[model samples]
Target: MSWTVWTYVVYLLVTVPLTVWVARTLSRNGKVFLEDVFAGNDRLAEAVNTLLVVGFYLLNLGFVSLFLRVDSTVVDVAGVFEQLSVKVGVVALVLGVLHFFNVYVFSAIRRRSRTEARRGAPMPPQAQVAAYGPVPPYAAPYPAPGR
Candidate 1:
């Protein structure tokens, strides 16, 4: 086989498994976090976890496939290695970015949920105004003629 074909082979061999491993790891570990975030809703947590894993697979695989093509011809073993390194490096970076993004989003959701739980159910707008009472009109420092 040609060096270009070898480069593609090596790239796929490294990236595909790496993607699967990372996705599985995230899904396995994220379940507990999701459960907590969803306030012990196991069904919802599992459903969201599955959806996240599916999304992760779609994004990583799409990136890997899109990046598989080499711009230049790979002539030898060194060239193949060099090409593979660049491709794999880019794939790794993309994966890391995606991972961090997912973490940030979930963290934000978790934080919001925790805050809401602490605050309990929100009061309606009318109830809020009633609870606080009506605002009095501003009064001048000096009294009127009547004193």
Candidate 2:
């Protein structure tokens, strides 16, 4: 077969399995975090985890498919390697970026949950004012009496 065909084969071989492996890894490990974030709601956590997995598959596979085509013709084995390198490299980079994004978002949710748990239920606005005492008149944007 031609180098172009080989390039396509290699790209598919590399990206498809990589995508599946990443999705599975994330789904498996993320369940615990999701459960914690949902505060022991296992059903809700499972549902959200499934949804996230589906979304991850769609995005990664779509990107892989879209990026499969080489911009230039592969002239030889070297060209094939070069093209594959660029394609697979981009896919790897995108995968890392998406993974990091998911981690960051989930971490934020977990952190917020921890904070709320520590603080208990939120205080109402009036309760806050009452607890802290009324806002001083001088604290307002308007000028003070002597000013």
Candidate 1 lDDT over 1-147, as tens digits, reads 898998999999999999999999999999999998889999999999999999999989999999999999999999988998888999999989998998898899999988887887767899987998865679566778876
Model 1 residue 135 CA deviation (Å) reads 19
Model 2 score (lDDT): 0.92
Residue 115, model 2: lDDT of 89
Which stretches of candidate 1 lie above 4 Å from their native place? Answer: 121-147
List TM-scores for all candidates, in order. Answer: 0.81, 0.80
Worst 10 residues of 2 by lDDT: 135-144
